[model samples]
Target: MLNAGGTPNISGFLVDAFGKHLVALPGSQRALPGGTAAQPAQVKFAPEGDELLVTEKGTQLIDTFSVGFTGYASPPTPHASSGVTPFGFSITTRGYAIVSEAGSGSVSSYDVEDGKHLNSISAATPLGQSAPCWLVTTGDGSFAYTANAGSGTISSLRIAADGTLSLLSATAGRLSAPLDMALSSRSKFLYVREGNGAVSGFRVMPDGTLEPLGSVTGVPPGAQGIAAR
Candidate 1:
């Protein structure tokens, strides 16, 4: 966990399942020489279980941490400048990291082990979808879905075996601001949290399409995060 809002010296924490404090690691003083402070927005372990990827929202960079958090590497401008604001990311079973770029309204893929840029699919390329803030991948790692906040839609992309990405489809999402998303354990369903404090559920079709199952009401306000067990 990153102390994103901390001042002077940002830090990372090693937490346990029960939310117990385990270890605290210090963050780099600066993301780049004489650059802005580092503010980590999201952290995810690589699918291969050997590396960690952290999104520095403040510095617009991705920080890779070695296994056991023993080493660190900051890739200078991993994603395109258009997609600099990396907000949410998901690792594919094949060890590819898919990151949602809110600034550029695109989704980018990277090699989890070496921090190499793989490919990027724009939500605005053929479709007018924009501001994809969050993403979730199918259990099989064959497909990915991003919640487009600006266009209020869901953009689907097909993930090739070699970690390449291609736009598949964009469908209307029944929400104002789709912020976060999660896939069911078996990848049978997808749940999205909207800005209106409602959770919308969709059935994940075999062809990587979404079938709306309506929304769940009565959720608390400002509910922006969700996960499927």
Candidate 2:
């Protein structure tokens, strides 16, 4: 878990799924860039599972770390992001990194080598939306979607085999303040969490389009995360 209270440090814990318990390991807290304002938005494990990547919005950097056996992370090596306000991101099936830039309302792709070195694969590709705060990629990594909060829309993009990106639809779907997003385990359904305390579902079409599956309301206010299985 991240202690994201305007601090640059992150804490790691051990989880016991069957017991629904969390154990904070000593010496698991590690500092990132911008000591007091890293504003790290998201953390993802590399495809190899031995490295970690964090988006530092405050510093416009992507921090990479080597994970130790005890779940502790090494001192991070920071790389400048391809765009501004890097927020949500994911690793592609080909081990490339796709990131969403909230400030620019665009997305960028990177070649992550050894889970630590990041080489820009493609420059920022504008989705022509606003505040794309969350991103999700299809299971095959051929398609990706971003929830544009400011524009109340979802944008789609195509990911090439070499990690290059191209805009698909800047307004794939329109909703109210879409924030976080998740894909079903089978990658057949997409779920978007709205700022209005509601969760909406969509059927991912064969051509990388979205078909509304309606929504469910009554979620607690301020909820910001969703998972699908």
Candidate 3:
């Protein structure tokens, strides 16, 4: 997310067919809101690919918009995030939005109707951890994980069929200032980016538990985000 002339904007990019070229599409930028304190911490497209959900920290809200065929966006529809300082989130196949609330150290879910309207399905459900800022969910949409930066821990939760969440483990794994996370293509492995110059790996168990796979050190310090393939 970029602050475009004091407004939060989502930029568009184009990649060449050969995957050797990339370019910014300036005209495709969609401005979320202007004249407000909106720090978009994370953005994810709905499973249908016709909508986008952005967690705004500064405004403590989640903004959703309908995406047009040409990549333009409809006016943003703001919704209470059901918690404070909403950060990373994932939209499930059933149109459920699961979000991590850093300020409240909890996770919440909502029903995103037709990519715009939002209704809370679950209030903030605490995991007894601190600063659970970044989140990732299973491909099956049955579980979710959050990296607790302040507590140096990872927490797991079972995402119910109705978009509710239940804490599975408060300390599923440990890291040093975990900031961002990604899951493997099969959602079998989970990786975390640590502020302490390392990325830790964990195996995803059948019951939503995490088994430590150790850490890869020597990553540049202050690395903020990560992706796994």
Candidate 4:
């Protein structure tokens, strides 16, 4: 947990479940680059190590932190923004934490700099389906896929060298109320969960499209949450 309850409208907390005690972790915050002072809506740990990346104020920007037993160290630096609502994040094997902004349906890439944000990946058009809620990237950082809950479909995109984006097609496909997504280590399989209590698995294709593998029932009872394997 991070940045919970740090705002007047919210309570952000970083709690660790060590042994049996749910110890509360210290809370840290900054004014924000967007100047809106919006609350941090989401957070993720780096795939390579303990580095932490967080989205502030509806995915307007990103921040990093180092972890220690007593507490976490200061963040590396404030990364820039893609002007998208970063609702979720995923780390690639190449050492980039791919962040998803559900509001604008885009993804932003960052390289660690002096424990701060130093550089950003330049993307072309926005990534994935419109208004994606979360995403998963490939092992080599060649591709990124997302679950666009707003359009009730999934979208695929190719990651550019500069970190910009290009959609594989103008449209992805019809899906359930997708919330979160998960990709397999081999990148051969993908998963998406719906707010309406449906789970699905898909097989990957050469052109970055999906073929349904299987699905399940008993998802959520409301239009609130989703998950993927």
**Top model by lDDT, which number?**
2
Ranking by lDDT: 2, 3, 1, 4
TM per prediction = 0.79, 0.94, 0.92, 0.75
What does candidate 1's lDDT look like per residue over 1-229, in tens digits? 4445534122344556586857655653323211347655677767765566667566666666554444343433333322657777888888877877777777777765554443443332333477777888898999888889888888888888987778888664557778889999999999998888888999989888888999977878855589887
Mark the regions of model 2 whose C-alpha exceeds 4 Å error after superposition: 16-20
Top candidate, metric TM-score: 2
lDDT of 3 by residue, 137-158 (tens): 9999999999999999999999
Per-structure clash totals for the candidates: 0, 0, 0, 22
Residue 53 displacement (Å), model 2: 0.8
Model 2, residue 150: what's the lDDT?
A: 97
Quality of model 1 by C-alpha lDDT? 0.69
Better of 2 and 4 by lDDT: 2
Give the worst 10-residue stretch by lDDT in candidate 3. 1-10
Per residue, candidate 4 scores C-alpha lDDT tens digits across 1-229 of 5434434121124545565655544454433433347566666666644566667754366777664544455634565566466666676655666666777767666665434653676432475457776777776677787788888887777766655566775355567677767777678888787777877888878677888887888764764534433
Compute the lDDT of residue 8 as modeled in candidate 1. Answer: 19
